[model samples]
Target: METILFFIIVGIISTIFGKSKRTQGQSPKKPIKVSGMEDIRTLFKELKNEVSLPAAPIKSEQKVEVLQKSNRTLEQEYNQVRKESESSRKALAASRLQREKMKEQTIEVSKDECEPSISMEPNAQTLVNGIIWAEILGEPRSKKPYFPKRG
Candidate 1:
């Protein structure tokens, strides 16, 4: 409301000055409005251009090339997978053959272990036979007693 009152006072002062100037034989020039400016049209044109600017375009060619590269890498990976699978098959076959050979020699290992091949030197009967005598005398120490040869 105060702004409107201030504009009203300024308008009345301008009217009074116009009348006084007219009485002195001088016609007052009209105050120019915004229509007189040359740059106003260009200002509107710049605003319209800014509003019409296009959005940035999304590119897909680089992404497509990356996908193709990944496909080639997957192909190489599958080749390596196949080679490792063949190696594992060969190792498994060799292990099965080795297991069969060990099974066949188990009988010989048991025979050798059951009867150890002792030497029959002259010291064997005296030294080892005295141990047999000591074991026969120590029979009562065990749950089941043992006796030496009667002969």
Candidate 2:
């Protein structure tokens, strides 16, 4: 509450002072000008005039020669990298093809190795005996005897 009252009093005082200053036709406070591109450009021009730097040591011919040498070296490096990339790509393709061939061979080997669990069908009696054994092992003996129906 005290803070609120203080803020209100300050606001009122500031407004009163502002009105008085305005009515006087001339304000004591001057309008501030924001710095713009033109101001920055003028400042830059003035700074350039005040501070002078020594000229570069290299002549135009030397600069051109250096630039040409650097360009040639850069082009050579680019071609070398391109050749290396192409060779690596070819190696990758070869490895992929080898991997694919190995996979195919593995699949063929697995097919050749696998054999069916039961090659021949069991006789009817053998099947019945198997069913009876399965029932005996799988379930508990009940009050009524269990028997498999004929197919």
Candidate 3:
């Protein structure tokens, strides 16, 4: 509550001060200009005038020779890299093809390895006999035929 009252009092005082500053006829404040900017630019221009670095001697024929040699070397390196990249791409493609072929071969082998589990159709008598093992064993016998019978 004290903080609220304090803020309200401050707001009223600030509003009065702001209105006085805004409404009272007063002369405009002059803009402050930074000094030394022109001097710095004059110094820079003088330096640019004083310093005369002659261009490095570049004979037209030598320039052509260096450029030609560098171009040839760059072209050769580019060709080598392109050749290597091409070979790597071919190798990757071949490896992927081999991977696909191996997968297909594995599927084919698995299919060949798997055989049919039973004769075409189990007879009615065989099916009934298979289930009767539970009654014969007497102690809730379960899937005894499914468990291979001992000789």
What TM-score does each of the candidates earn? 0.34, 0.44, 0.44
Worst-scoring 10-residue span by lDDT in model 1: 25-34
lDDT of 3 by residue, 15-53 (tens): 999878867855356453456677888899888866765
TM-score leader: 3
Candidate 3's C-alpha runs over 4 A off are 1-54, 117-151
Candidate 1 residues lying further than 4 Å off, grouped into runs, are 1-69, 115-127, 130-138, 141-151
Q: What does candidate 2's lDDT look like per residue over 58-100, in tens digits? A: 6899989999999999999999999999999999999999999
- Superposing all C-alpha atoms, what RMSD in Å does each candidate have to the true structure? 29.9, 13.2, 15.5
* TM-score ranking, best first: 3, 2, 1
Displacement of residue 78 (Cα, Å) in model 2 is: 0.2
User: Which 10 consecutive positions of candidate 2 have the poorest summed lDDT?
Assistant: 26-35
Candidate number that wins on TM-score, 1 or 3: 3
User: What lDDT is reached at residue 26 by model 2?
Assistant: 56
- Residue 132's lDDT within candidate 1 is 89
Evaluation by lDDT, superior candidate among 1 and 2: 2
TM-score attained by model 3:
0.44
lDDT of model 2 at residue 94? 100
